[model samples]
Target: MRADRLVSLVLLLRRHGRMTADRLARELEVSTSTVLRDIEALSTAGVPVYAERGRHGGYALLPGFRTELTGLNHDETLALLSAGPGRGERAFGLGPALASALRKVVDALPDAHLATASDASRRLLVEPETDLLSRWPVTEDVPATTMAEVRSAVLTGRRLRLLYAATGETARWRTVDPVGVVTVRDRAYLLALRSGADRTYRMSRVLAAESLPDPAERPDEVDLDRLWRDRCARFLADGHLTVLVRVDPTRRDDLLNTAVAVRTEQPGPDGWPRLELTYQDAWHAEWALWQLGPHAEALSPPSLRTALHTRATTLANRYG
Candidate 1:
């Protein structure tokens, strides 16, 4: 609490240049005696803080005093401010005291930047229901500080201690060599190689992590893009096999625009546009048929056509 008060006093003085003792006491919600004591403590800690007497004086940082983040450019400054208190606290490993300190830095920005940042904050709202977040299981909140550190290690190719919770297993710690971090939709993942292996783990499933000492023998250079592509291909291969569909002429535009890949479009016997869509599997094809309703139908693959008919029968039975 004392440390927090001291940090707040410093920030206030830095932002306002000077303030009366009474005003400081009021802002900090402490007695004037507490403010005076804090001022002494900050001075003792090498902060160039001083008091002045008379109508114009309270407390001030000595001229030329600057904080650690004084060199950030305008855009960087806005980004820091936009990240808000939650991210700032986590990114810098600061608790409440550090949050108070960052507020001063944000407050000290030029008026124009401050206004712009404020306006942006009001206009930009990040809705929480993104696809990745929706799909991810609720486990525990990942601290911002940990995520930032993990990201740093990933970029630097450093080994890290990861506390991972595998599906159907208790969380256990492991030392991993982090390769990178990836974001799919709203979910965050740490792509890391296990200490002795070539595979990488997702960060979301990771419970906790710590950086490790650099290895003596470096692993072979990894082509991250190639690895990602291969992983995706494998995942798709495991899904349902391909199926084709035909779209009605009235819905041809929607099919052409919405389908993953529309292979062909031509008039069928009834003057409807037959859209050939190569689906990843039967389930997907059936789902598409349901979405299209009577506007499209499965054209080939007798098995899928039969499945669709069966699904329609089931639906009719339920209603009947």
Candidate 2:
């Protein structure tokens, strides 16, 4: 409990600079006496924390007080930063500003940390098969100022007014209580409550989003991960058209990794792997078969195999 309070005290001072004992007590859900004792403990730890009394007074950290991360050696600090791509304009939509801030943070690191980070950068490289940079449409720029406001509203339990466009549709404005935001496959989505139902809209589809004054009652519980997974499962199940396929053992992993649903793998008489993969949709199966080339053979659901063969024949005709 004391350890938690001490961490809370440091974090509070870091964020708010100065807070009154009453404020700290309310935030930590502890009594004023407990907060005072925690303050004493922090002072003993050489934290340079102090408090002012009476009107216009509160707990404050001495000017220029800095917390040095002594435990994390230089290499460790650098490795941490280098381990993940810096969250950039794509996530924050701040363009050059985010890059500038990231540069500053990385540059300010100690020499050891800097070296470790440099080494890690060289050692580890992640290249997505398809470049998302090209897919992101720069023309649909939601104002950075408004985007920040929406993000804040989501964090602080507020509502937002969203101007959105569905695929092949004109933009329309609607009021939604912000629930959460999800980044899936490098695409940004806003999860919100609309018309008594939970909904998700692509951030790219949102032409504009502004925080609104009207605040809806926050839900008692928001299991966003579960909710999103359920939505995805339902969507996939509804879209899927069951198709049985026989996949060569050599290409089994490839098919398993693809976007197909409910795959069952078994060995054939020749000890080769055979797979029955359900395609969420006919179009997807047709596309997948074409991609699989010779490694996959359609086995069941006569209509699907017929369609695949027809397409393959058509392709052969065109190519030949």
Candidate 3:
């Protein structure tokens, strides 16, 4: 851990040119004393770090002394720098690592392209969690400890014990063979096998996790991309209930959030949006539409219409 902290300290000074002991301590989440000790360690280890004693003085590395990564060309470096900010590395608890890597990449670029690449990267802004419509993308909060356990199990081929809560379900304990983890739109999913059956658990819903010593049962080689696609296809092809509805323009995103998918959309006769939405089941359809109140109307599937009508009537009666 000290080694990592030392490298991070060096990278920090390299990136910012100078940082006070307090600033370094805050950045590294350690005390000022620890920062001083690390700085001494760096100096003892032949690092060219020096201190400037003054009101505005702090620790800084010697000029032009940096760790270089020379493999990337100008375009490649630009692409990485431009795309690094919005990659949602924090979702996987690798935010620090990503930041360190990007700093190294910048340090490695040729002097001719260094300024140009930094400027170019600043021009391209990507926010994966924010869409054009300004709707905040749904995200899950996963604890660092749980993520570390899951990641360890997946990487080490160990069995993972999970306390997971599925959608609309109670939390349950299960031991699984972790295949891999994937991040989509700021949400993380852990693909694993439970009792020889495929299981995909959202990282946010994982209440607790542990990496067991027992080895996992899995293939010698895995194609996670193909597995994810196949599972998604199978899920979509399952017995999902479809509903036709007309929703107010303002509440469209509210409906979209609950619906499994939007099958079709068009302008309604009343100038509202008519959408064919899919749900997991009849109850799911009723609940999702009910959340929108009068802003959404179920147009087809007599059973669903009757269900909604009955519920609305009951509510009216209660308040009448």
Candidate 4:
């Protein structure tokens, strides 16, 4: 796994002080190019690692750098292990590997702290995938091979070709310069540039991905979090159909899951909660409200009200 390899790379550097790219590659059993890419990723992630240019020059961690978690006290270890890997690892197809890594870490803990940390980890409970309402967690199924290709492309800074199935569009081929991958709420997205334009593709929507040999054209440094936020803002700002809804407070979460964004939320005059929601279009707005049945009422955009009323009347007359 890349995570394990990265950790091993750091440990190798820390132990050996300095090592050439070829030496590291042989140790890690990966190509020299792959070792170089890993070093770049580590540097970008704020690890105090730097390269030297002379013949004796190689990759090295800054002096006195330590990647030790053994210093963690019992409580700290418990908290770390208790939280576990969760769905994020599964989303990235690293569940088993992460679980193994955690076990290794626990095993490496001091003998005095080991038993206590293990027992404590078992005692603490993380939230279940299903909630009290029996709503199952959203699990996007991105093929393992597809995810691997995309991940490799991002890690290696290579260009990518994707067979993407975009929302409301037919599946098509696209070429992009991959920047990074981000997982939010169990959904993975590939953040990349398509012809110098920002493009984000949901990992599940990528039917297939090919890592091209050509290097990706991208800035040396990236602010992935900021870029993701900016893209999200632009997406939410475009062609959204605003909806004002009065809904049963208990069903608010259900309503939220279906909407694009929640603009404003307050108590309604009728003793219910009022929410200003946005959807992709009028149809989406109407459908989301309808799903809640009488628990939700659309209060604006005459057209949506009429559409719902017409549907209700049609159903009512047929059932009557």
Give the best candidate by TM-score: 4
The true-versus-predicted C-alpha distance at residue 319 of model 4, in Å, is 5.2
Better of 2 and 3 by TM-score: 2
Q: Against the true structure, candidate 2 has what lDDT?
A: 0.73
On a 0 to 1 TM-score scale, where does candidate 4 land against the true structure? 0.73
Q: What are the per-residue Cα lDDT tens digits for candidate 1 across 180-275?
A: 555543356665566455555655677777876684133567676776666555554565355566677776655554444555566777787666
Q: What lDDT score goes with residue 304 in model 1?
A: 81
Scored by CA lDDT, what does every candidate get? 0.67, 0.73, 0.88, 0.88
Instruction: For candidate 4, write residues 1-320 as lDDT tens digits.
Output: 78778888998998898899999999999999999899999999889999898989998999988766355566668877887755645756677777887888887888878888878778777767889889888878888888889888888999999999898999999899999888888889999999999898998899988999999999879999999999988888888898899999888889999999888999888889988888999999988999999999999988999999999999999999
Worst 10 residues of 1 by lDDT: 85-94
Q: How many angstroms is residue 236 displaced in model 4 relative to the true structure, after the best TM-score fit?
A: 2.5
TM-scores of the models, in the order given? 0.46, 0.63, 0.61, 0.73
Model 2 agreement with the true structure over 1-320: per-residue lDDT tens digits: 56756776778888898899999999999999999988998898888888788898999999888784334444555554554454334564555665675576676777776776677777765533334335332234456676687788788887888888898888999988888777654466777888778788888778777887778555857998998887767766775776677777777666765655654667788666666677767787777777888888777678778888898799899999
Lowest lDDT 10-mer window, candidate 2? 130-139
Cα error, residue 14 of model 2, in Å, equals 10
What are the RMSD figures for all models against the true structure? 16.0, 8.3, 16.2, 10.6
- Residue 287, candidate 1: Cα error in Å is 5.5
lDDT of 4 at 34: 99
